[model samples]
Target: MMPLVHSLSADDEIFSVSVSHDGTRVAASYNDAIMIWDTHTGCRTLGPLKGHEYWVWSVAFSPDGRSLASGSSDNTIRIWDTETGTELLEPLNQHTDEVTLVLYSYAGTFLISGSDDHTVNIWDPYTGNLIGPPIDTGDRVSSVAISPDSTKIAIASFNNTLRIYDFATVSPILHDFTIHVCDAATGISIGNPFRGHTNVVTSVAFSPDCRYIASGSDDMMIILWDAVTGQICAEPLAGHSSGISAVVFTSEGSLLVSGSRDHSIKVWDVGAVIRRVELANGSNSIVTQRIDLEITSVMSLKDVVSRLTDWGCTDMSAELDWTSVGDYPISQGGFGDIYRCKLTDGHEVAVKTLRVYVDPDEQTRKSLKHAAREIYTWSKLKHPNVQPLLGLVVFREQVGMLATWEPNGNLPSYIERNRETDRCLLGAQIAEGLAYLHDLGVVHGDLKGVNVLVSKDEIAQLADFGNAVLREYTIQFSKTSTKHNISPRWTAPELFRGSKYSMEADVYALGMV
Candidate 1:
């Protein structure tokens, strides 16, 4: 096959580059200006944008091709009205230091820019207004990209960490990655630094569909990242004999063009290059290095709260309880006491105070079992509707299980109060809970209404897994309670036979409900 066609030049060292969505116009940033040129004509320049005070580091065209944004060492981002050749608004002036890069998200609704100030700022391009809180990176944020679907933001920083943040909150969805690291750090050295050109990262651009991010470096390498996981997916694009100046994804999404200090423009068939690296060596070279965060896979709030409960962690909002509140003192379960304690932070936590002062000989075995059964299980479960185990609270004779509080009470209470209305809904919720547990390869051997909690929304969650067992894994249930809706009327036939419970058994009980 013909190698992807690219051109070369030895003239002005290009600092930054971007292509219009139609693949017709190309813009390059140099010393103090941006040069707009026609790709097909190979013309010297269509126009020169001359407003930056210092070196312009990056430039990007708006999705609709009507506007252009440039970031500069002057500590400002400028939005120019492309059609009118007039400055559209005052420079977006929030960076504490030089603005390093500017990019229009795929939708053109927001402009994201990174700076030498160790921050990434977001702007509403239409009104030239700051949109959300500036993301604090704690180190120079080298590059930023809003994913194609616009749900994620990837920020590569000088700390050698790639932080994946949720677009909605700008909170870290995933953190502490080593995709593009500063050479100063001590870890596994990425052999020869993608051609050994020495410098920090300077630019990052996502593929047209946002599947990959192309990051340019002062080191002269262009590394492509799997946008989904924030991991490196290709070997360093190393044609540039000097520091790579800019990296851009073509509008057609098939090629990535990079400009370098060596004065050459290289076009790459992204598919061939990435596929070779991905399938080479039997596994992706960067799979382990890339941290992929599946935003769309996030569970609902209910699942989040539920997981906290299952893990014995309290919600950040629960009321703090110093003294026990109910008519009954905190009751003890198989592993610990379920104290209804309010956290100092006002969140209700199911403090499972471990039975203190256990016999020494039994401690090791019991601790091992508890670690495997409770802590490990809680840590792995991530779903919105599932209760999350926030953390452990330890006391003299007890370990507290701080999880979310289900205010509406358990399934039995809701069933007794709501009767007909709650029955079908609660039944469905119980089924869902069972399905979730099974999906995670768990079987709540003691599945029943009393072992289930009902949220205010009437959603049912399977609880009290003290007697739960992993399907096909032999761990006997120490003890269990039968109360309210889990009485003989709701008990499955297998329970009477002392048969080990399975998801099918949970379904049998759910059907009873």
Candidate 2:
């Protein structure tokens, strides 16, 4: 489809375009500079953010949208302050050849780059320092992507092969990433990007039920994809006359929304063939200069967590106000901070805000994944001895896991206060929780008294799945590395040698506790 906005010199073509993680800003790479636009107004917000002397090869926005990173043919990488459009001082100049790609880790902690020099370099953008020696790809690198779990890096090279490197194994695999439906057992992609749009496909989203995929295009239509068959499932949604640029689904997938350059946001029911509602900026409907053309853009949901997991409307996270977080942290650990928080329902909870980091070792990554999965599953756990994860609250850039509020404090603190009472009751409560977890094939690798809470009823409830997640993810560490977060005094000696977490390991911790 022809662009609504055009430039005089078509030769100086815009090679790439990107939307910010929050979907507020749009960016495009031109011959010598990068341009930023307001996704709503379609007006230039910042740029030409000019610092590169030659063609800008790639541009990416940080996850938090605080900064912009760009690589160019000038053989250097430059970062820009998004608000002021000023180039960060002291450009990164490690590559001998032109840099082609620059991407921030999923959490915006580190910036990595690929270059024509046939090497990938990791950078701590906060300090502009290289994290380690570069990994030589032996061919000109075309693109680089970090895995969703951020434990591996994949590189597409000009030599017509893909390379994958794992942080844990320090070994590389040569071929992956072209959007194939991989078999769960054999690891082969049977499905690729299903293409059908005639003009520029502006926006794509998946339904909450995962049965349908939606695409909005400049062709002025929306198509629902049959995910199972990789074909168009329903009739095309035709309403907006101008090309569409953005599309998103509500939490339930009952409704889909699309935005277009014509300046309108059209809402459509999942199975319907027509628009249900049309909203425009400044007015309910926008009227373009073309008279017949009008449009709407997407809007941020009230809940920031919705920004990430809208498709999973039943997700563990719910919107929480920043004010709910207490002024002081109850405790802090290597990977997160805990706070006493008040939920919107007017109840207290223990909140752990995960520590966001970059270039983490395999152990740290495993811990994060394990903890996250447990947090996701904790909502389904029902037992008096096991603390129920109330839900999740993510707002203002802070993510927290909220759980049962134990006013009586932790078990260790309770034991210290009530030195005279026998601790057998609390031990039994912990044992019950362990029994429940064991039945589910879960190992509560760390079972110190510190990880147990005393409820208001003076009953003990197991708390802190921080180590529980580590066991689930199974951290991979070198044989010589002994330093860890596991409580050595409470831990079984066999665990120090990397013994698989089993019922016996937990029983040992329980016996000691």
Candidate 3:
């Protein structure tokens, strides 16, 4: 409720402000110059570090707190030595129009800039040389942000859309609007866009941990987003009375600072916002406790059932008796074997059982936990294009997941047989299913043609949730799964670099399918 920490006034309309990594100093863009102020004393420490020919629009501090970067209407980016108050290099003159935003990657490996020329460019902050070809967004860019891992770049434009690009390849992978979290390496949209803003988003910053994104909008509001799930983390912070020009989180990510066109800068307590949300929802602690239990305790079948029930899987009590039709499994999956089975109701189903080891080692426990997670995620979904979770069955002393059996089998086999099938319609259906999952904050981490089943009606139903994850859960839950074993053919480039399985990664896989 009382999140504000400081309110520093400036003499002129402030365009952008960046806080030092140590939170000791702040840099503000004023007219054609940049000024540095002591965050605690509100006294000018350095600057009027003047080199720009026109209005300076953006400023950023390097990760080490020794360098500053500024972009201006002069169509250039300037890196300044923070200690000496001197220019570090020749102006970075790559853009053809006013530079709108400047940002440094969390590791200070590279600097990114957005310009009114409708382009986003990457620069080697040390040498003042362009790292790659500029990415064309086809609209005047408003802001740019680099993910903490430095594999992705997010570009916001006047067109009201955010485009994500792979930092390594410099190729666009996803485009959407109203603020979005994207895969830095594949440019695939991570999840549904953050949609609370009523006007153009002016700036965005990713927390140092990459768990949250803070966005500032012309509507004079700031929204904190759960970067993993694309859910608003807290109620909108609405102290600014005019359009917000910039927003950034301190290196520790415990504080957020914002600059407004009203010539005022505000600092906010990021922890307070999170604590407030936790108090309102009463679920954050519950999720933490559940994650702790899964990681620290070797769970029994009864424990798994109890956890599932707590997550709203009451249907586990359904009295449907089922048995495998043959002595062998029809197919093998990542964590289990799939068998064709018949229910007591005379309905056919596919049953997947985890390959539980009798010795119950740590890996075995993790595999069981993943199975429970898959069941919990799938049970909550109810879309026509998404495969339905029927119930659970015990097979050979192991718990198995049951789902409606598709007569037509997986997509590839169905497509091979029905060559004349409407491929476009199937793709649309698959997209719809993925979109539905994303809307519910789920990531179908291992999306591929084989994971999609086709029914007698030729409807594409997404299945195989062994690799699926609910984004609302902590990242540790997803890390426990065998994500590394996912086929590289459909995996996003970022995931290979050790990034978490994300909605953007799922989108990349969807494109592959």
Q: Say which candidate scores most in TM-score.
A: 3
State the displacement of the C-alpha of residue 335, model 2, in Å, after optimal TM-score superposition. Answer: 43
RMSD of model 1 against the true structure: 17.3
Candidate 1: regions farther than 4 A off: 1-11, 161-163, 167-241, 263-513
- lDDT per residue as tens, model 3, 364-453: 566566556657667756555789787765666666777888899999999999999889879987987897677556788889999999
* Superior by TM-score: candidate 1 or candidate 2: 2
Q: Tell me which of candidates 1 and 3 scores higher on TM-score.
A: 3
Alpha-carbon RMSD, each predicted model: 17.3, 22.9, 22.5
Q: TM-score of predicted model 2?
A: 0.43
What does the lDDT come to for candidate 2?
0.62
lDDT per residue for candidate 1 within 1-513, as digits (tens), equals: 212435645356788788888665677777777766544334444456778899888889998988899999999999887766678988888898999879888888889999989999888998888888898888987656566676678787868576767542121111221233222222234332222224566555657565676777767777777665556675667677777777777776556777776756666656555544444643542211222221122333334334444544444333445554454446654555575767776666675543423233444334333433444465444432356566654443334445667877777777677767646555654665566566555666666666777755455666665555553332332223122123576567876787656777777777766
lDDT: which candidate is best? 3
lDDT of each residue in 192-308, candidate 2, tens digit only: 656666766645666655666777766778777766677765557776656765566544344455555554444454522211121112221111111111111222212323432
User: How well does candidate 2 score on lDDT at residue 77?
Assistant: 92
